[model samples]
Target: MNKSKSLTIINLAEKAKFYTSLCLGTVAFVSVFAFLFLIPFVVDPAITSLMADYDTVPVTCIATNHIYTEGISNCSWSSCKEGCTKEATRCHQIYVNYSKIPFREFKYQSHVSWDVVETRFLINPEGCGYPPSVNCSHFAKQYGYTTAGTPFPCYYSRVYPEMVVARYSWDDTLRHLVLSLAIPNLLFVASVGVLSYWYCPGCGRTCQKYMHHFPAEEDEYEENTYYNSQSFTKIHG
Candidate 1:
């Protein structure tokens, strides 16, 4: 009886160790993946904002009324066509006129278009109506067009086009940021789960071995749990 109890305790200890190791391994795996994928979002504002700004098109493209513009941010304009669902409809219509600024390293051309799109969730429709208004007066005094500090200079046109600029709301920016972050995170989690499952086969086998020993030890302790019935039948014969 004492031997059987000792065996059971040893088995339990082994099983516990196996399961603990498995759990620690899984946590470590997930931690590594989280650190790798979550770093960029935390470190760089440009990268974090990159997704949010994805929907914004260049003021130059809007000025010319062109659907697409070279080197402009691309986005689905339809989602905001009616009105933004979240926040205060932080949407606006941008009217950028490039002629007023002085051209130095980069040239500025006055080519513009217009749009009444929701750029963010918090914008009030009262102060900013459905067809948002464009504010072009801010660019008048600047020597050169604001390039958003781009390495390449702003495109200049000799014709002095009255380009209409369209400014995007902050909500669209957030939407893209969230979508971008989600993609890698989901992939990381799936990978960690798969890896955890792959590495845990030994745990199941160990538990099965422990359970199989239970009946044999129990019979020994009870003396006739398994053999008593058969021996009694023989005696009757």
Candidate 2:
């Protein structure tokens, strides 16, 4: 092949290699990010949502005046008494006074009945206390009615100072997944696109402008040289 043609082929090859390297580098970065950050934050929640039998039950908050929050309320207790009575096997309530008594340790376990499962939190009196605003008597009354036949009410009202129990929600898991995985992934993709376009080989503004101006200057110099050589040959002839 002619010298110019050979040079053009070599340049094309080099540009192809460079572009391929950039593509590979982008893929590597995305892979690493997905493994280190995305999988745990994003994939885990989706899997948990699919595989786990039930969404995590929130912490139960039992209040005074026979008020219960999160699980079952006082009024509905009668109608659902069968399930509620059955639930007694797996469910129970606890109160602690955080202000008066320091929490020493918190623990919990799961109880399964037939195909159903219930998570129960164990509160230690040494670490449990009641918040000032809560009415312990109401919780005691509610507990008394619900576990009329069971030994649960005795455990529910035994708080040192009397405190309410609350559980973390599934919404927290979703929120974390979005913040850690979804948002970061989107930002990374957008940044990579912007950067790739800005520095792309022939498509980049600076590269295109340089390639345009540089070839014209080279051609102009070659033409000038050719004319000078012709003038010298004619003079000699």
Candidate with best lDDT:
2
**For candidate 1, what is the TM-score?**
0.25
Cα RMSD to native, each candidate?
16.2, 17.3
Per-residue alpha-carbon lDDT of model 2 for 1-237, expressed as tens digits? 699999999999989867866775676577557657657435564445433322233222222222233443423222112221133222234322121111121123233121111212222111122344223444345443553323121121222212222322346545755666665566567656665775677567776788799899999999999999999999998
* Model 1 agreement with the true structure over 1-237: per-residue lDDT tens digits: 999999999999988867866665666567566656545533233343343332332222212111212221343221122222323222223222342232341244444222322122111111122433322223221211343223221222223222122333445545645665665566557656655565778777887899989988886868765577779889998
TM, every model = 0.25, 0.28
**Each prediction's number of clashing residue pairs:** 31, 13
Give the residue spans of candidate 2 off by over 4 A: 1-35, 50-168, 204-237
lDDT of the structure predicted as candidate 1 = 0.40
Error of 1 at 178 (Å): 15
| Top-scoring candidate (TM-score) | 2
